[model samples]
Structures are given as C-alpha cells and as structure tokens.
Target: MPRSPGGLETLDPTRQRQFSESGYLVLPGFLPEPLRARLVPEVDHWVDEGLRARSIAACAAPEAGGPPPVLELELAAHGELLTHPPLLRTLTQLMGPSFVFHHLHSDRHAPGIAGKPWHHDCEPNDRGDPALRMIHALHYLGGLDEKVGSLAILPGSHRRSADKTALAHLGTGEVPGETVIDRLPAGSTVLLDSALFHTRRPAPDGPGGPRYFIDASYCQTGARWRPVKPYWRHMLARARELGLSDSRWPELFAERHFTEYTGTV
Candidate 1:
C-alpha cells in the first residue's frame, strides 16, 4: 500500500488509483499540530462531560429525545474539522465535486476497550445505486501504536455487495489478506470507502493511553442517502446557522441530499 508522504493535502494520480482499487488511503500527518492540539481537548470534553452519551441517546431514540445539547460539529475545532480544506479537496478528487455530509462522530477510546467486530459502515442511498460513493474519514488524533490499538481493513472488499454485518462472524480476527495498520504518527488519517470491511482491534495488553478517534462521513450527491440520525435535519440546520463552511460549499450541509430518517434498522 502506498502511504501519503507527510502531507496528503492533495491527492495525486497514484493516490487516486490506490483508493479506486484498494478502497482506502492512508494519509500520515494529514492534520497540522495546531489543529490537532485544539481537537484533543474537545474530545476530552465530549467524552468526560457526558456529551458523547447524550449525542448517542438522541440518535438511538429521537422521538422521545431531542438533539443533544452539544453536537460534535458545534465544538469549535470539530466544526472546522468538518470543513477541513485538504479533506474536502481529497473527497472532491475521489468522489467528484458534489457530496453531502453524512455524519460526524467523536470518541475517546479508553485503554483496554472491547474490540469492534469486523463490519462496514456504508449507508444505503434511496436510489439503491452502489456507484454513488460514500467515504468515511477516520481521524487518529493522537495516532496509532501498539498500545493505542490498530485498524484492520480488507482491501477491495468494498467491491462486494454484501450487508455491512456480513463479516461480523469473524470478530476482529485477522483475515488472510487483510492489512493491519498499527503504526502511524499523530494527526494521521485513513480514508475508507464506506463499504470497505474493517475492524478495530483492541490495544495489546498493557498500560495504553486513550485513543482519540473522530470520524465523519460524506456521500456523493445524485440520490438521497438514508439519514442515520433522526435529528439529522436539526443538525444540518444548526451547521448552516453557524456557517461552518460559510458560502463556499453550497451542498455540504444541504437537506436535499438525504432521505427522511427512518429510525435505526
């Protein structure tokens, strides 16, 4: 696999090809120190202050609950991250110039947290068109190491049309041809085709630091994609009200790109 050299501020021909064929791209040191420095504290607050839990509650059962008091994007640094220039440019290069924000998630994975089963995170668009793309940006704030845990990804698996949980039976077990990415620098990021099969392997037994991970997804515009959060409309409205991207990205937070929230499946 070809790793981005220091900065993936822009994708070159080779990087584009890698993503097209491999279903993923590893961008080491993609975030600047200053931006990352600001994001760390926000993650701490999101988790420590119970905001993360509140956010999840609103999604799991929105009829009885309202939007969380604080959204991840509302956090100053998180909001900036949602519209990071390099990320948008790379997405535009890979999935075309038009795409809408699908969702954003932030978490602090404590040491010895349970490993996640192998699965994909792709959300279906109403048109049922597989060609329409959705990409997930996995940001490693403090980076990955033996102690922080690693990500396992099955290359080219996105090409297969299977349910997201099709691979869950394997748990986090290593597959014959999967790639184990355990070593990376702070501020590194891995972009995956949302349909790509991947897993979060827990940190090896030892004293490990909390892993600060934030992920945001974007879907190419053409068809309305299913909304994961019932309060997604409110989320987008707040984003527009706050002018996260100002007037530059007309379609970034537009409500037309999504189907009505159908509640969790």
Candidate 2:
C-alpha cells in the first residue's frame, strides 16, 4: 500500500539510535495543522460538556458513576483522529508492516484535578516480552505549557525493572529521574514506548489553562489473533479502494494459527 503522506518516511540515524536506547522520541509538529484544526473543536466540546456535568473530583471518583459519559463520547468522537494517516504511517514504520489499535482514551483535566501518579504502562501486564507488546501516541490538541498539566516522562525508563519497590515509589508520587515535561504546541504529537514511566500532572488553576490530550495505544498483533472484528474484510476493501490490494493485501491479511499440545496423564 502507498504509505500515508505527511509523516517521515525514515527517521534519521540519530533518531533511530535515540529511540532504540531511550524507548521514546519527540517529534516537533508531528500532526500537521490541517489535521489538528479538524480535531481540536471536537475535543473542546467534549471537555466543556464534562465541565458542565460535574467537577473534576466527581469525574475522578470511582463511585461517581464510572468515568463521566463525556469520556466515552470524547473517545468515540476522536476515533478517526486515532487513525490519522500520518500518525499511522509513522507507527507502521516503527512497528513493522502490521499492527492493530489496542485502545483509545481521552483525558480532560480541568482546574483542581489531581495529578496522576507516575507509572509505567507495563505495570498491569505480565507478558514475558513486554518490549514488543505496546506503544502509545499522545496527541496534544492545545498548547501544553508548564502552568497547565503536561506529561512528564523519564527518558530511557522503559528498560528499568518493573519491580514492586519501583512501582511503590511511583505510586507514592515520588519524582522519577530526569523528568521531561512535554511542552508541545497545539497540534503536535509524542510517541513513546508503553513501558516508559510517565504521568500527566494536573493543570494549575487559572484562565486559559491546558487540558489533557487524547492518548491512544497500539500493539503488534500476535499470530493467530485478530485485533478488531471483520479485520480482513475491512482492510481488504480499504486496500482495494486505495489501489493497494495487489501490492499490500497479502501482508495486511496474513494470519497464523497454533495448536495446543496435551499429553495423557
């Protein structure tokens, strides 16, 4: 298939090395203006609706009716944003030829919201090969400055041990090493390995503050697994429309199966 336009076809050798060593890479103006302009209003409307419905505390509280309905609305509304051509192309380049969307979420933090605890995405998983499991794309819809809540991450932390003690420190809100707060302007994107230690600090109270961005995760699909239903049919149709079926259909529709081994006791 013809790759999407707007994303870098090849990372510089320096960047490739940096990504290999640190498990993260920051690209300036990753999302072009046209795409960002299309997505921002949708995000703003969702956040405004959330603010109107309840306070930040209410949304954060578990008993306050599982994540305000707007959260889901925001997610569903931005589904296309998750699949933007440039972003998808870059991800394809990084993760090889095939991958699937794992999850999509939107985080809108108004004034008074508590900062998230620092932690790695790998904490919830027990996979033997965590490195190849997942990666994330965080899209900034508005300016993320120091005053407003911004993502802070520990570069190269993905290689660190996911031990109880380390997890405890992060859970208790201990600042991790060499914090880098992503100060991206509106329309930029940051891609990071899921295993990296990171969190979004709450926005400070004031006028024209920062809000959380839509964060989407993707993972390499395992052999014999279909990440989404009707995967083959959907992609095949898409590939045909794009004139990619003849060239890329096979790789796109490839599948695998494994047999279980059982022995008599």
Candidate 3:
C-alpha cells in the first residue's frame, strides 16, 4: 500500500483501483479498541434516552421541528471518531484531501429488526455532477457476522447515474454480482461510494444479538452538496465549535460545501 507522508494508513494503488471499480472497501478492525469501547456506551445512551427517536421525529417533521436535542456527533466519542486520523487518511487517499462532512448516524439495531431494501444513499449536489463523489464510512462497532446479519452491495453500480432507490423492486433479495459481507472482527469499517446499491439482510435464524452500527458520510469538495438534515447549519457549526477537525481538515466543517437544506420527503 502506498502511504502518504502524513503517517496515516494509505490505500495501496491496487486497493484504490478496486474501490473505484467496486464502490466499496472493507477495513477490518478499523476502529481502535478504546474508541470502540467508548462508542458502545454512548450508542446505548443515544438509543435508551429517546434521543434517536427525537432525532428521527425532527427530520420527519422539520417544519414542526426544533433542533435535535443532541446530534450524534455532539457525543464526545463520536466527535472524536468523526476525525479519527486513520479513517480520515484513508478517505483522503480515496476522495482527495478536500472533502466536507456530510452527516453522521448512530444506532443499535435489535436482533429482529427488518432488513433495509436495496438502495443507495447518495445525496444530490447543486452542480449535478456525477463525477463528484460522496462516501459513507460505515462503522461496525461490535462487528458483523451470521448472528448479526450482513450487508450486500452491488459492485460498480455507482458508475451509473441513477436514483437512490432505483433497485427498490429487489427489496433485500439477492442480486447478481452482489457481494455479501457477513463476517468482520470488532471495530471494522466499510467505506462505500454513496451511490452504490446496497441492502441489509437480517439474520435468517430469527434471533441474534444487537448490532452496534454508526455511519458517517463525507463529500468531495468542489460544488456544494445537498444537506439531508434541516438543521444542517447547526450540525456544521457544532462540529466547528468542538474543534472536531483538529485544525487539520479545514474544509471538513465549512458551510460553503452545502446548499440550503431542503427537507427529505
């Protein structure tokens, strides 16, 4: 792997080529153990205290909304994870150094929770340039396996410009050429080009343990990207206030990278 002088893990040219061709990369045990430990408890608090519900309600009814009482990145460990050096380095190698923070979501999915349909999560940009990339870093805090279910992705699907849910007809059913990621050590992370088609498949055995998952996204900075959260400004502001970028990634929290928030319907 070719490493940048910044001392962060760099993707080898081969791996970078694979990501461009496949639209995803799996980094096993990407999150350091200590950080993973802190995040697990914080996730429990986020879900147990009804913050997750409130956050969803705010987004669903942004017109009737107050800001979410606590955004996911507002949590200390999450804030740290947002700027984790190795992850950022990998992202830089993949998306270039000038990328803006898009969003962060934290959740602990119970064993019986239903699978998500085949879909892509690429947000729109004002320039409408398909070449501009948006990537999501999916952190599997407790890892994934047969008991916890799996993630299935269509390789190279991101190359085509398509609607986020163009593959909805498939639901979570298997697709030709799909790659299923079912096993990883604790603290693994999967990086995906946001436009790639993916589906979540629940454990087939009908019961299992909770899955601790956190997903954060970033956009290659050139044109402004659309904001999914109505309170997008506040989210950026909070990230800046907390110095989450560590004075290293100047564009990471810059508001100029986003268009005004048009609530998701």
- Which candidate number maximizes TM-score? 3
TM-score of each: 0.95, 0.67, 0.97
> Which regions of candidate 1 deviate over 4 angstroms?
1-8
Q: Give the per-residue lDDT of model 3 (tens digit) for 1-265.
A: 3446876587888999999999999999988899999999999999999999999999988889678999999999999999898888889989888999999999999988999999999998889988889999999998998889999999999999889889999999999999999999999999999999999999878769899999999999989999999899899999999888865688999999999877683
Residue pair clashes in candidate 1 = none
- Please report, as a residue range, the 10-residue window in candidate 1 with the lowest summed lDDT: 1-10
Put down candidate 2 lDDT per residue, 174-194, tens digits, no spaces.
364646654777766788887
- Note the residue pairs that clash in candidate 2: none
Q: Which stretches of candidate 3 lie over 4 Å from their true place?
A: 1-6
Please give the lDDT score at residue 254 for candidate 1: 95
lDDT of each: 0.91, 0.56, 0.92
- Cα RMSD of all models vs. native, in order, equals 2.6, 8.2, 1.4
List runs of model 2 lying over 4 Å from the truth: 1-8, 48-77, 123-127, 163-168, 171-176, 203-208, 223-265
lDDT: worst 10-residue window of model 3: 1-10
TM-score-sorted candidate list, best first: 3, 1, 2
